[model samples]
Target: MSSQKMRTAQIVEYNKPYQLCERPTPVCGDNDLLIQVHAAGFCHSDLQVLHGQFPAHLPLTPSHEPAGKIVQIGAQVQGSWKVGDRVGVLNFKNSCKSCVGCRQQLRRRHRTDPRFCQSREMAGFKHDGAFAQYMLADPDTTVHLPEKVSFEQGAPLMCAGATVWGALQKLKPDVQPGEAVAIVGIGGLGQLGVQFAKAMNFRTVAIDNRDEGRKLSMEVSEKLKPDLVVDSSAPDASDKILEFTSGEGLAGIVVCTDSIQANAWSLEQLGNGGVMVPVGLPKEKWQFDSSALVFRELVIKGVYVAGTEDVQEMLKVVAEHDITSHITMLEFDDIPGIVEKYTDKAMKGRLVVKIA
Candidate 1:
């Protein structure tokens, strides 16, 4: 409400640097909440959007993971959402209520269907997103930020945390408490996956080729650290994982990296009747051995960013278990620098930009 104009970082063209410029503040719609963005997370998806891998409207603001205070509430919003409330928003929005996915979501038959509705608009991809000072959020896909979690952490939790949370959920009915679970590629998402698996009472194994990732998995928190960390590049990595599981192999594996090799290898570490949930998107087509899959009765499922209910539970677990993201905080102006950093080497943890 302070100004009609707002500062934004936009992808003016594919494969080019962002353009920092001014745009009119977004108008809050009947079913939308206007957020005064305080903190926004920089994710690999942003890079994908920039490179045209994830097609987007050109000259669009970009950042899907955003956490901030509500400036205005829409009249049609059904919840107790109001001004001054802290919140984090999932990227998918504008669901057509008449669609099959939306109908299932309304009946609670499927919790994750609304986001998959064909008519939905994806923030930072198909629509203007949170890279601006203010953005519109759909109430159906938004969650409250706990007081214990800061805006910086809450921002990344909207995407990275929700993603791993959904992947782990796929293991239910197959993997149980005290069973071994491996979190592959311990970077932004895998590190959190390990912690979440531990919090869920599974014996967790953190797998990564990088020294920083392995170190970060152990350093997350005392209550949520992985029980074991393995070097994925080692020749005996699968042997070590099986050994950790008392020679039975892992009951579940969460693939958090987009590396084709890592995903293929992770499938080999699963025990009989084990579940493998992949949350990462690789450019190349994924191939698996049919004989192994059929003989072992392995189950492979794909999960996207979590639903609103799942995200709420993840935040509760994060707050209760003291799980935190080791973040590199930057200002809004450092958007280009963050993009450059994500290209070559992986950062220790997630990247967050303080916008306000």
Candidate 2:
């Protein structure tokens, strides 16, 4: 395969469609793996990169959620990884291991924070990503895919799944079992959040807006089985949530939509001492009531994608619980169409490209 050339979807300019072109397969570095991508999940963030909404280095390949089999291993790479090993690539390609966050993660054996590392490199944004037949990955940032998880299921876990998993973790040690937790937005992340909340023994309430959103929420409930579903478009959305929980209000709310209105409304539904985790990146600035936050002692926290350990734990949860992402599969050549759909807000769940 030394002389092999692979097809890639390259973003040659901002606000432009990806150009499908052939390029030489990337060479494996000493601590890297050459992955033959089987599936790559399209994200709303990728659309942000394309539309110049997100800061990114130009001429980038924009699919961060990728899963595939290792085709080549670097000489220095070790520990169970070999040719044919199934794996999912993480967004953080590499991080400076000497930073405070890195030192904490290394010493604690869990990720406290590594996003502050000055040397962090992000796939699909700062470097080339898996929107192609083959992509390069650092072994340290890649997780082995369990046999029970299909490539399509494993792909979105790299970003969407791991993201919500990390966000849900923020509620830990505070949110007790049987406490009602609300997941706002029934799209890709919210759907996964509902499953994670249920798996962790939390009473899950799924919230969405409008008739279309209500229909999508119903579909998700049928598949994932949340405890309750709330349509924020209703006149008494907050009232219904409080009534459902017997006036206890939600213990925590995970805001998965990029709509500012949804985020604001979710904050109002939180009970005293409740936490609101905003996982979505809305282009507009958020405007919520400060007095409500102060009087109720509500907490609003932001989370990026998962750390290395979080990614591993997320994968284990998915495998152990038999969780699967609701994804629409398309061919590699259908990237243009998928991007259009995302821009047009037509995507329901997740979209995964069959690269292999």
Best by TM-score: 1
User: Which clashing pairs does model 1 show?
Assistant: none
Residue-wise lDDT of candidate 1 within 1-356, one digit each (tens)?
53599999999899888889998898888888999999998898888888898776688889999999999988888988878999999999878877877777767864435587879989988788888899999888889999999999899899999999999998998899999999998888887888899999999999999888899888776878888999999889878997898888889999988888888888989889989998888888887777778999999998878889989999999999888888889898888677776755766788898999
Least lDDT summed over 10 consecutive residues: which range in candidate 2?
A: 214-223
TM-score of each: 0.96, 0.93
Residue 4 of candidate 1: its Cα lDDT?
96
Q: Tens digits of per-residue lDDT for model 2 on 1-356?
A: 65789899988888778988888888888888899999999998888777776576767888899999999998998788879999999878666788887887678865434465667787887678989889888887889999999999899999999889999999877788889999898888887888888888898898888555555655643435788888889898888999988997899999988889888889999999999999887778988899989999999888888877778888888888877777889988888667777655666778999999
Stretches > 4 Å off in candidate 2: 55-57, 99-114, 220-223, 344-346
- Which residue pairs in candidate 2 have backbone atoms (N, alpha carbon, C) closer than 3 angstroms, thus clashing? none
- Cα TM-score of candidate 1: 0.96
Question: Among these predicted structures, which one has the highest lDDT?
Answer: 1
**What are the lDDT scores of the predictions, listed in order?**
0.88, 0.84
